[model samples]
Target: MRLGRVTLALLAAGLLAGFGSALAVCLCGYGDGLFTTNTSITIDGVMADWATVLLDTDNSSCDGAAPGIPPQPDRDDPVQSTGRDLLQFTYTWNGTHVQTLTGRAASSTNIQRFIYYADSDNDGLMETGERVIVAGWKGSNRRVDLYLGHYVASNPGGDPMLDINGYSDGYDLPGTIPDLSSTGTPDYSGDWGAVDGVSMEWEVPWADAVGAPGLGLAPGSAFTFHVSSTNSNPGAASFPDQVDDNMGGCGGGAATTQYAQLDFFPDRNLAAAAGTTVYAAHRVTNLGNGADLFDLTAGAPTGSHSPGVAFFRDVDRSGTWSGGDVALTNTGGGTAIDTGTMAAGDTLYILIQYSVAGGATGTATIIATARSGFDVNRTNIVTDTVTITPLPRSSAPARWPRPFRPRASTTRFASKTRVAASWMPARSRSPTGCRPRRRSLSVISADRDQARWPS
Candidate 1:
């Protein structure tokens, strides 16, 4: 079977007992933190089939100088060391299922339980979206038991351990009768003479055990793994697992590669009057694996308008600018805005303000681009078009009509009081007290030469 590249880091700790002897133990350390394999794994309790799997070896006093032979005395008896002395742990996926193997010291008891946690969301927190597998020995015959469940961090009443009959959020899986053989050689053999540790192996369905809804285990799927062991039944209400020696004593490593990603929202269109300001609401979310800054820039307007543009942070996330909103300064070219450090999964709301030119008319296309600061190659862009229409003009005529005479014996004149002008008819009383009314008009005689005065 072919193997992928592996990375390892060693972390060790020691516990002293009555004799004051320091017993070195391996804490959960990365050994080939993330890797893939195509080899088929059998669930029979054996170690030869796992010889090629990446080994996350734990620290053991058996590797120390003057180490005792098989059936070594409990180094931390009264100190309550781990109920099961975890010596080695590793796992691999073969397209359909995940196979795991664990090794314990020869003197370790069969009262052992293992919990495998999967952080499928990569948020660095345990929640319902994540998965956990609990496997342990049960009954007088030491029958192997298995379970599949999720962690509910918000439910204070929820139990971290799995129940044999199944819980509200978990399922009791059929047992695989794991192989517990005492023929596995220690990966970290020091002065110990031929110490064949106890080996246990099991397998679980990939879809049922490792994958969560909407988050399946696939190539490039970023996730994390952590394995722990206890001496009590996994279904017990209260487990007294040895914490000082084996709480996180095995298989804790991240299983993903780092990358950058971003998303921009709200590509829109708007309408505004000339010489007025209009704003567009936008939001950017960081979807990468680590903290990063983003560069926001506006493209030149494409159309009849050359509107002034600026950007501001919606500090309150209200989608509109307020007194608390802070204006962002241009980094260069008056088009680029800088976003401070943003952690993974963080989101920021922004307002793009456009000051329409006084003479601007017709539509203007504005493009906003957001690029990851850590990797310029990763970027997202949104577009907005503002339609500028001319304001309505007054319908009143530029000037008032001229006054005329009537053909009848009586003569009358018409004038606009708002015009403040003088007009005289051939035969009429002095035109006075002419006030502007809602309905005012001037009528002219049909024959200009034919005119008459009051008799």
Candidate 2:
């Protein structure tokens, strides 16, 4: 090789981790902080339990300088993972053994639980046995309730994406399982590789969810839902016999949360005396990829406040209303309430006249329900309190009155209103592009028909 010793060292340093894991390579500080802070991981789909993984390097029982290779031979060889699940970091041990590396392995115990939320009424969480009609959570018996694929490919690259069809390395485990040891089993090859993970991608549907706990019914206006995923050790899940009945995959799961809500008169705040329309608004977001079929019911604030037209927005931009957004059938009250859909990124705008709950500027609260189902995240419970103030009943001029206009002798059935005289062709003659135009006119006019004032 033309490269000198110094060049070789630099080259080794650059190629050490690039050919593989970005998480382990770039997040080296994170790896070092592992013991201080629990390692970070996330789960996309539903699975049985929490998943787990671990890392180690330089075990003396390991043969040669590295695992799975002959003592230094060919530069161009088949791209394969060394038998050991190790990270490539050039560090010296005990001030000796300087050129060695680190072994990085994930255990099956990384993930914990994937909580499916109820979507029927806006419940963001999932229950058991419910099938998805819409929204994020379907039910426990659903495939997402069972099989979840796992992979070692951490980033959202070509094959390893968050979607169900995502592929990692080549195969997928039901969930993230630990690596197989020295004997080189099927699930133990790639850093985060598995067998059962691949098949589940085709086996489940994560787009929509169901309500296992009598959820996804009707009549109720709003609800919330929640979702979670877990990981664990792979070695134990694959070869239980090898690790003395070891359970596999990451056991603790990482997660995220989001929601939707409604309000009567789902728009800007308006202050009306006793009988002014209050604009209401209902807003919905996917929170997840799943769509929601929401059954909503609303109770206008209980008070003497007058109620008029209900305000709502067309969330789907479909020029109509539908779905889990704020909607209702007025139960014979101050005002008739209407229903509509709150599509993804859509807002339902509603304007309804309401009587003041009390007298000056107070608040009114309304409750939303899915009629039959429950939202797990409690998102449906979002209430928007509106300010009700005394209506301005006194008639006032829309614009400021002119301060005593100079008298003019024109009798065009003139009323108390006075007009100030100006020039002919008026402001209309001003050439409007960038520069101001000057006009010549008479200061006073004796004739009504041909008179030009301020000429």
Candidate 3:
């Protein structure tokens, strides 16, 4: 049996107090597309580990009209300009930090800059949001500086530079890593890595990146943002067009292109045989943007028959076979399977072996549930049934016939029917009658000397 929505909510009220805000259960659509995951991603320059999360950016040149057209060519304007045509990128977020990888960096010969704007309130205007500018890059010492500030009619100089001689700010979060510090202390500003002369990467804690006096952004929170780059001559006064803008830039609709959705769903139910040896399988996937740690446990079975069972995993994504995947150790009764760690967008298969009892016949239903940070959806539980039937029995034997034996011939029976010969002959004619009358005597009287029948 499953609990109703109301009962689940009441129980969750107490169970979820320790955990952070719950994730909104929904599907993502549009923009570079929204992604959710439950795995911790490293912020190194190489983006091999970004398999779980998705990257959102624009590619159309500004030459044609909106919608089906390329962005307009670069002009002598900084506010409304299309910087580059092939500005490709990728990104992902753990609950605490956001990571971004750029396909094309600001051209070295020309003065190029990237502005990352975030509207935490989702009002479509930057008047009440945050913006981070990465500009003034030069060779050696990686002269790309990062600045954070609230937006208004003009540029609000990010007071204490976030990345200047290792001087970073403290945004008051638990176990936060530092990017840079001004007082020669440990604090995070923005950590970046060099991919190539034309590409770059950056990682920043959400609290510091969203530059507010006392503001913080948690997982499952929705917001609008724009990623734009400007192009200009080296040390020139005017900047040009910004192409590949995910959200329409400073002048257009500037609408929210993406909505952050968090969801964890198990594919379907499983079934297996009862008496015979068989396996039941289920796959659980992480559909959220941040890395999540999940706890897996089995609910009590519906039937009385207890099938001998064990769980296994496909660690290398190969088909589970001997010497390929490993068995998981049982953690008491009804508890998490294995270490219970699932990365975002990663799927883990649950292989359960059912060793049904000798005479047990019935449908045994087992419920497998996966619980992660704030993912209390009841649909996340998958139900599996093991049906067993009894084996057939043998029938009784037939009756026997009466005992009988025919008189045997001197040697062997040569005819189809056996004929018994008379011991003595009766009177037929006058001569034969007298001969037969001599007598029919007992074997003892006639054959006293020869021990034969009388004739």
Candidate 4:
């Protein structure tokens, strides 16, 4: 029967103190450093735990240079313009959807509204992967209308696949718009509610933000967004005066903008032996908007083979040796490391060095979890498995193949007792892709020639 090299290694008799039966062990090094939303959010316009408020000072005017062009008051104007700086808002998210609340002090039947432009890929450019959410409060109907933009695969940077007028409760309408409030007009009551100068609320699901079926955005997914308010009458005083002129009813860049950051564990896995120190590498990637810091933690299975696991930051991307790398202190109870800070799009490799306790053997598994700030979730947990087998002792000389490369061969034995082999450290290139480095190797038996460990 064909067996793996690791299994063949177990054929030897009498290993050091820690070998007897097959065992498994896990080393959890990914800590809890993810920023996650704990509670769900309601679509109502009220500001709750999942919401953040934005003040009038946050307004972005389309007519910043010539305030009189839009006939809106400038920031220096003590009189305080009526149109510009007329609304304050709040925002929140709950993994599945995003909610917003806006309010103004004046009462009007027709209020000029704005839309949100999203940089989903966070590359600082609005392209095919990006999205736009058009939302506004219709004082005339005392309701809010939300529209999601679908990008044309052929022209991602061009106008959305569907025009602004393509608003409906059906999926066929350009992009899939949430069935907000009823379908048609005149008393549309789905995902929005509003009262002139009082308050307005709106909610958009994660599917709408991604623009397609396969592009689902989960918790810890982040991006940058800018809100721009527009008006038909340029001279009409608006909530916030634009920094630039609203040429020919054209809108300028976003007025209010912010970078969003989120955290989630993407990859983790490993393999090791009992009583032997094995180096395992786990990676954490940032899939958020702004820069963020991740706090990592882990959980290990209970067994006789207590494992000693240490986490080291892989300063270089190689995932091999180190250069001024930081070693995290174990927080006991399974928590192995904390990565500290990681920028968006950056990946950090966690080098986990673990060894099983002596005289212990059986299957063991380790799980690691990560969290950033208040973000934490069980869905991002990563798991690793370890297998341990007792080393066998042999009395005679035998031919052994290199590690990871198993071959069937016959040999003769002269003695009945297992021969003790001395271990020596050496570095060389091997068929196995292990990096060239010094590692532990069992080389000789009583009356046989010494064998070299695979590099």
Clashes of each: 2, 152, 37, 58
Instruction: Tell me the spans in candidate 1 whose CA falls farther than 4 Å from its real position.
Output: 1-256, 329-336, 394-455
- Please tell me which predicted candidate would have the highest TM-score against the true structure: 4
lDDT (10s digit) by residue, model 1, range 155-244 = 433333223321211111212212221222211111211123245556665554223222255534444444555564443334323322
Q: C-alpha displacement of 59 in model 1, angstroms?
A: 28
- In angstroms, how far off is 140's CA in candidate 4? 5.1
Across 1-455, the per-residue lDDT of candidate 3 in tens digits comes to 25676664554343222212111111112333334444566654344443334322221111122333223221212224332321334455666666655534133543345555565544433443344334333322333444444443223432221213221111000111112122222123323434233444565565643332211465544445445554432112232122323322212223232332233333333344445766655566766534444556667778867777666765564433346667775342334554254444667765666677777776777776666532333225666677775555675546433333333322112322222333234544434232222222244332234333435
Give the Cα lDDT of each candidate.
Answer: 0.51, 0.28, 0.42, 0.43
Taking all chains together, the TM-score of candidate 3 against the true structure is: 0.34
Best by lDDT: 1
Model 2 TM-score? 0.27
lDDT of 2 by residue, 55-82 (tens): 2211111112232353221111221322
TM-score of each: 0.36, 0.27, 0.34, 0.37
Q: Write the per-residue lDDT of candidate 4 for residues 226-250, one digit (tens) a residue.
A: 4444443222233224311111101
* Candidate 2, superposed: residue stretches over 4 Å from native: 1-269, 303-311, 314-377, 381-455
Give candidate 3's error at residue 76 in angstroms: 12
Clashing pairs in 1: 26-59, 45-179
C-alpha displacement of 223 in model 4, angstroms?
1.0
